[model samples]
Target: MKYCYYILSVSLLILIFSCDDKVDLEQFIDDSEELTLVYSSISPQDTILKVRVLKTLSSDNNIEINNSDAFVIPNAVITLSDATNNSVRLSYNSDDKNYQIEATQLEILPGATYFLSVMVDQREFTSSCTIPNNAVTELAFELTDNLNNAGDLKESVTIRFLDIPEASNNYIVGARIEDDAFDLFLDFENRRFITDQIEDGALLASFGFFNNNPDSVTDITLQVANVEPILYDSLFASYSNKENRQNPFYEVIIPPNNIEGENAYGVFAGFQITERLITYQ
Candidate 1:
């Protein structure tokens, strides 16, 4: 059974360019290949491993990529192993179209390395990532007001955290409303990545939060994620170069993918997130 498989990693970017210049897109479409894409991120807080595998599609294809079954690769052999040689092979769940490890034997811990391998179409592709030790010692938030470009008072948040350097530690912080009150922002917003290049051990880090709601009162959860160096670099590229995926005038930037193999892109990352809920009025 041949299913319409749109690689999730590549599909989102391709759709942004579908209505743009067809002449340029023709070359990209023609150059497209059926590459095996692997995207998985694991954390100890989560119960099961959710891995997505898909094949790339052409820009000219009319299949709706948003369809639940749009680009799912079924019944692929997938395995994940940690540095201590604790490994678990995943089984495919047709309902969610994701490869999952149900036994929960794998522990995603800081300073641990994880390797993921996928067997598809007679090709074996692999990617590895390490989990960084917890760097956030303490976290506190304060409300503040800032003047936007229009000279109007805008609400913002001030976040402060104590850091413990862990081999060039990199961090991404953000906040989101706990409930479904505001549809303006995603569950996680105000995303920013920072490194301890300037601030060393026992350093104090502070930054202003990017809040969309000006005067709204709600409960917001702050997220502090300790991302590995490799994964940090890839996310940094994806976050910084987001415009490359859009704007028709500039060439799209292919966000760094840690996967190792021919014609494949994506990351197998591990994250340790610490959250604190704050009531703001």
Candidate 2:
């Protein structure tokens, strides 16, 4: 697949890295209780929101992604409650093999807290998460047509956007490029979740580089998502674990989960997305 690029400012990088905590290994304890294994996330833009009820994993905690039935919970009753306190009972979609309800039936809004409950075999699991407010404005980007170091056609970029003001808010940022036949996503090793505590709510700038194919991009987009704490912490820790896998001194960090139930495990959360797109000129 073809590739696209974006850059994080050097000063921002320094500030972000400075938050690297000195984790004391021996002082850490595993007092946290494990809960139910279910997956669910809601967004205003979704046509159909789905909640997957998963089976318990093996002793080694290994999951087989391709085996649908091995992990799917049978006869689970799932319900979603919106901000207005209206609850909807989701139906199991045989096609998708998951519990779902149409987004139109339940209007979800940013800054609203929602609750998810699942019942399986007389046991009930529940969790609640707040959708963060979309505080980021439209991302401003300047693109230049160019040939990358690989001699392929590419576009270079300079991007700017406003920071989310709340320190509790952790946002995920990424870029994507698309053509009619294919789309490419961007990820950086140096950056994953960004929260600017030092210059919260201030305008921030970033720079970039990319590789090109199909000669040019048909469209490009910037995705900024502000998410709640458990979801943000879970994703942030997962990203760090992936990046540090090659280092000998690396310690694996478990992603924080919010689901609550006996003999269950997993997290349920929501996302508020802000996206801006630009077509090739």
Alpha-carbon RMSD, each predicted model: 6.7, 10.2
Q: Per-candidate TM vs. native?
A: 0.76, 0.72
Highest TM-score scorer: 1
Instruction: For candidate 2, give the lDDT of residue 247.
Output: 94
Candidate 2 accuracy as TM-score: 0.72
Q: Write the per-residue lDDT of candidate 2 for residues 1-281, one digit (tens) a residue.
A: 22121111011111112122221112112323322467676766567777867553332334343444555666899989976789999998776557888888888887788899899989999998777666466788776554544585555665677876665566666566665554334433235466676676877654345433534566667666666666667666656765686899988887676788886656677776667877756
- Pairing residues by index, what is the TM-score of model 1? 0.76
**What lDDT is reached at residue 278 by model 1?**
83
Off by over 4 Å in 1: 1-7, 10-30, 93-97, 148-152, 184-191, 202-217, 244-252
- Give the alpha carbon lDDT tens digit for every residue of 1-281 in model 1: 24333445432211111111111111223443566667777766557776778766654577565653656679689999988788999999887577887536787777778899998877888988777666475678777776654576656666667666546666766655544454432212223566677867754443443334534546766666666665666655654444255566875545568889888777777766666778878
Candidate 1, residue 273: Cα displacement in angstroms equals: 1.8
Error of 2 at 251 (Å): 0.7
Q: How many residue pairs in model 1 have overlapping backbones? A: 2
Q: lDDT per model, in order?
A: 0.62, 0.61
